[model samples]
Target: MGKKSKKGQSRGGNSQKKTGQKAGSGGNKKKSTAAAAAKAAKAAVAKNTPPPSPEKAPVVPEAVKEEAQNGAVAEPVPAVEPAEDSKPTADDSGLSEGVEASLVLFTESQQTLIKNLCSPPSNQAHLFDHWRKPSGVVSPSSEATNNVKRKFVAQLESMDASYPDGGLVGYISNAKTLLANSKSGVNPLEGWKPSVPTGQMFDKIDEEFEKVEKVGLNEVTSCGFVLVAGGLGERLGYGDIKIGLPTEMATETSYIQFYIETILAYQSKGDKKLPLCIMTSGDTNDRTVKLLKENNYFGMDEDQITIVQQGSGVPALEDNDAHIALDPHDRYKILSKPHGHGDIHALLYSKGVAKKWLGDGIKWMIFFQDTNGLAFHTLPLALGVSVKFDLAMNSIAVPRKAKQAIGGITRLENEKGEQRTINVEYNQLDPLLRSSGFPNGDVNDEKTGFSPFPGNINQLLFKLEPYSAALEKTKGIMPEFVNPKYKDAEKTVFKKPTRLECMMQDFPTVLEGEEAKKVGFTSIASDLCFSPVKNATKDGVALQKNGTHPGVAASGEADQYAAVRKIMQSIGCDITDAKPATYSGITIVPGPEIVLKPSFVSCPADYKVKFPNPSSIKISARSSLVINGSGVVIESLDLDGALVIDCEEGASGVISDLVVKNDGWKKVRDGSRDNEIIRMRGYHLD
Candidate 1:
């Protein structure tokens, strides 16, 4: 991709005042660079009518009226009904002048860089030069629109492996299609060109990554890292702070701790202790702060770690039947809603983090959630992968045979019929996806399916400069979402949390091979990246309570057991004499029949055992059961004293009556439940 003008410098201002405006008042006076993006989205929906032929429309829509009130437009908008007071205020005039002034800061070289940033990659190369030469002007007549679309298709049809000019001409064709279809009531082709205009500053960053030195600990020393830890533990019953829940074999270890260690380790390798930032939600920020401070930043430098408060914008729920917004307070009294992690891009852009990091010499920005600790490897390894592939990489996991969870990579064709990347969940998986070599198996067991899912871990690595460049180049390319938007008005009338997934993948595609190189993406093996502390069962809880973990196990224990049993028979051990051996707390038990190898016994260990690994012994309870040092004992008295356990856990299990005597509660906490054989907060007792 060619370079563009250097219009990528950061602009600082009050975000709220600049992003919205009142009806007929035009857009906000103080516009951020992101505001001038194409309105093709809304235009795409209004493709039927011919576009207004003027450079700017005389009559704006009711939507624009509302948009004006919110100050959402990037260009200076004239008042619909000019009033004496409607004249541009000094601040308004200054903002308009300021934007144009700022654009001028970019040199010719910079504008070229910006254009490259917006160009698509070679593999899926097809350009839309709406920012430069739009199609509506070339073909104001309906026949011209048809001709333009046909010509664009013809160009794609002529493509070979090595696309001509890396699909540069295809881009110009796309812009034409957009203009022909655009009904923004404004002529989209005014002053259009096959490329970005000169003297109009445009900042450009390569979408593709280039190897800096092999990333080392030294690089970590100077970088500042922050994790988005804003989600509540609602899915897990919200009994405790999700961030504080023990996720490591040692009770002291947690998801956040692992994340912290990984980043700190990278920094340490560089011999530069880096600063770590954690964005916590309002509900858990206090406890999170205390825990971090008490632990002295969990083995990292105290000053190197900082906790910041995340967003509190909860989308209002709506009643489907009444078609009215509902109060979230009606459900949970203490629900501290967040605007979702997608807010990171906007927040960072507006909050000046991008500039701050740039000044601080941070070259790349890696973002991840605090749930999965599997891909929480140090930045060196992740950065190495990113640079190696020249991609804005995302760490993914191969889907289970047919596991049905949300979210997966999607491949779609744009108007140019060029392959593009889209990330959506299983629900949104298009019909084309099923035929696209995705895994497919039994519906019940998604793991058995034929789909090969790149399970997104929400881990991303991006060249910070390139990301900023892309933002500058495609400024205001995104739509202002009405957040917390729910689908089913009855069940989920909450603010539709419109995911900014488009931007994450879209930006990379926009910069591929030109301003950027390519967007690299692949899946990491489960063993290498599989530590997720899902608070779902007794076993998971028990594993965290005990000190035994399976982090370093090379092979499955069941396989080990099978091997040992065969060896025992070869050694003439008496298999008939074998009986259940009770062991606990990191104890190694040799089979009475002299098995070749001894199996290690861990009580809570089973709780945190890695998924898909089979356990030797399994135990489960329907009503209630007691787990003690003697091993799990059934206490159902309804079996006529003949112990007969009905439930099963892990692979298979059946246990019968044993000497079970207990009043149930083992602890004396005043708030704890009593007289219950099995105690779990959210489980239903029947």
Candidate 2:
């Protein structure tokens, strides 16, 4: 169970004194004034002087004491330790007997810190009033516990200062309670319903797309984009930044370049520059920033892009023991880990970016993960939906195939008996319930059927005002999940406390029950709009052996590359043979030698004018056709292996049976190879 606060208790203010004065008789005006003046003077003094050392107790002003005696406030009292013969009671400070026993393991220094932090006389006690006692047993000797406690105390102190509202501490404590409860072997998905977005509303997506495009053009200035790119390309077998990896495009552009191009294309439709915010983690921040600088911000104004780094959190001990050594050199120190994408909300608020967005008349923010390529074109449509429906939170979901192994968006009654929408991760659902068709079960609503449970793809459009207001109301308290991970590559032991994480998608739950109506989920075409590059290679055998679904065999990079090629082809680009062509048992490679400029076929509408009679041209995928100038010609040619056709202004070529394996062919002024061909396979170029 979570911690509970006393009814009518107020925080961070003099509400207690105000309540007491209101209850007092009207005759003590002079005394009340004196007390108020004294309190003000003490506050002023405390502001000027440095904070008292943690080694000593804080000093209370005599004025405060007088006010307490006069019923204006309650006197501070230290928590009493139960007698040796007495049994622990539930009403005792949130700490349980087991947790108290575990604290005995901490060193004296750690004990002092914990005591000061939780004691009634301490200023921080109120911040931790909601902490529930640990339910699990934790036994450690004084020395061992002391070492662990020291590190924990230091981490807590730092977090307290960093997040004064107690979000970090509250989240950690809540995570501990959740982990303990989950160990009972009960299904976490009990009573929960899983459903996806229904696409029955909009008749034509193209019409909706056009409507959204118009709205986006009108509100481009008042909108912003946030890209969550905090992760490295380690999972994709790339040691450096993932966004910088080259894609299989005609120009061999990187992921970041494609994203930038898309953004530029969208901006070109309007006059105002849209702000692009990139949320990066510590590992990827520097490299990402450097790459952007080197590329000249990808043709976008540097001022329009803002990069913010998310904060990190301390990793918990595997045994929940305070004395365990996190490292060989330092028994008390623990490793730090990223606090999950959920921290984006707090980080944006803390950095004042959220406030700035609100002030800038930015009504909506389009947030998408960095690993996606389709996200570039999907933003305007998402924003349009938010505008059309006047929604506070709108998420874009894609259809989930059977056993897709992704989280699904569902509507269910929360603990308060109010209907709400949530993202139910794959692992959170019970296998029996999942296999039985879940929300589509007989228990589903008679009026609303569940044939589609659209999977969440992390593409969201949030109304700035309501979203920010909701965040403030929740005080950034996000649901934390414990992700058990190995402490080392050997996987011998799991890290303690597990990894506490939160998700930004869960922010919709923070809104009041009534506001739930303003939140919605919209379905999108997965092929056209959802392609996440999570892994480098598709290990079908490994995935099947582990009982997990092996999604598309094609890599994310390959999928994106293919999508781009398909779009270009649809635009009537005479590049049907742009793909690698096999000849004589050898596969020829493309790119660097064969390139397609974005200006040639910017969109499908430009196809007819760019390439008239597209069937007349034969451009092999592996062949290199460099059209630096115009008037390029395409004729019958038996092309095989790598072939280079450089056409200048007013140049044309007519070749036949061109077999240039391990060789190169340069088009001369007369539209013919200088000497039939220049074979340089395995030979140096001069």
Candidate 3:
């Protein structure tokens, strides 16, 4: 919560090799001033994980792997045969002659730092001492393996001055848990009872929603927004950052722009400009920053947005000793992996952003994932639920399909026998249910025809003070687990070095008694707010044929357009289906393409006010309307083709009494062309 007074001096890289290599790689300087290095090295353990490559997910060391939202992990791998190449390449002699041979992989400066911190008589020596495998005689590991112990020592000593020594101890404890989970094959839901959690459910945008939205509108000025966008859009067929993609082609507004606009729009309705914190990984950090800088922070103040990067290079662990794993291709490189989005909490806390928001008088923090256009549409009502219920934590959820890929919001008893309503991981949900006496195991409710356990989209609302309190208790680090695939039943060697992972959605686990009671969910209609852009066009088609939901850009865009049309029809407009368009072997439902700019109309109440029952508005098949501008009002209009009305926020728009019907932007599916939007979403407009 205080200033990181030592970061500047500490971040300057303690040694020559570390000069430009960010401090996390265990680069502490002189022994006389070695404490800071110990702190910096600690960063490699908690901040994030995954290797230099393995862009998707760091392969878990266990047969079973844990996956985070926005990404998938491979299925259980078979017991691997020890490949000749993967074995450690020892030096000519399999014994350490001196510090030079043992610490060959380290820079001279790093070697010295390790010695000063873990040499005999130093209390921290145990950290290095544990890296050894002592037989009858103190036999040194193979020269190559000696370097691993040297790495272990340097990693432990490289913590920052700001990180308490206690924090380093905490990470070690987590590493032990990772070892236990790897051996036991972690069932995170062990000893827990799973059942539906109680919360408010909004079936539609009715009077109740409008009433709650009013409360949310007032609360907007006091809230902070956190966006989890640590991954790219490769799965969605976009080669760049997913958040940079457009929500819909109507105005072709980039997701980032819309998010900023939505925040500002709500701010304008309330009092002050709220802060936005985006969590990024090594993959998306530079581009995300460049995007904000290039677009002038999307019309918001530069300081209003804070971009924090997750430490992607987490050192992988190989066994129960909490030994740092070596890379298959290169032993010098400690196999780093992504720590999952759960790193956001620790990043926010370690970087002091969460505390800063608290200082700014922000009472609430609303968290959402990137590339979901409908999330903000229902955010106001959801925020209202948080305020009205005085909730400590509110997860915005949707009715889930049986055995869906998504995690379910369930009330469960943890290992401590404490009850917390949280998102139970999808993999663990069914098994836990079946083990707990539910025959069908995570099936749909008979009456509702949907899973009783609400679907989690990773969108959440937190009452700031309590959330911060919880973060501080854990030093902002989530309880992380390591997944290591083993080569045999003995669990002696790894199939592949694995990484540590935690879920940001696992926050409720950090809470105690009554604070846990305050954790709940706000279930909203899926059609209104649950469209996620996740898969690529080909993958979508493949998934569809296999009876899976094709959560690709095409479907996301279609859902957005459908949401806009449904909202219009509910108000007063006569909206009907357009001719069906098929792309990538999947048939997009018949519907007019409509893009509603939040500036024009955000909530159901706003749309109802602009167009009453007698307003007389009808949008025909193939009509595409793009509307923007806060002052835009349509009292009467009829369109059969593309209609674009764009203006400054307070300027005139496509006003009332208009009848325009002409050939609009043509929908073209030319595969050879270079239209990014069409190519990514499987349809183009020329």
Candidate 1 local lDDT, 1-686, one digit each (tens): 11111112111111111222112323342232123213423353455534333234332223334444565554433322222221122222222221222223344643343334233321111122111112223212322223333333333233211122123233233323332233222332222111101100001111111122233223444555657776655444334466764332111245567566556545533544555557676677887888788877767877655565644443222222112122232210112123345545544554456566766677777666666544443344445555555554334334433334545544344344343343444554533343443334213324434344444556666666777666555441332222234455343343442211113333444553343334444444343344443443334335535642322111111122223333222223222222322122111122211111001111111222211112222222111221211122222222111111222222232233323322221111111332111122211111
Whole-model Cα lDDT per candidate? Answer: 0.36, 0.51, 0.69
Rank list by lDDT: 3, 2, 1
Which candidate achieves the best lDDT against the true structure?
3
TM-score per candidate, chains pooled: 0.43, 0.60, 0.76
Clashes of 2: 14
Residue lDDT tens for model 3, 376-480: 887778878887888899999988878898888998875666888888778888888898878889998887778888889888899999999888888676666
Q: So what's the TM-score on candidate 2?
A: 0.60
The C-alpha local distance difference test score for the whole of candidate 1 amounts to 0.36
Least accurate 10 contiguous residues by lDDT in model 1? 196-205
Superior by TM-score: candidate 1 or candidate 3: 3
Of 1 and 3, which scores higher on lDDT? 3
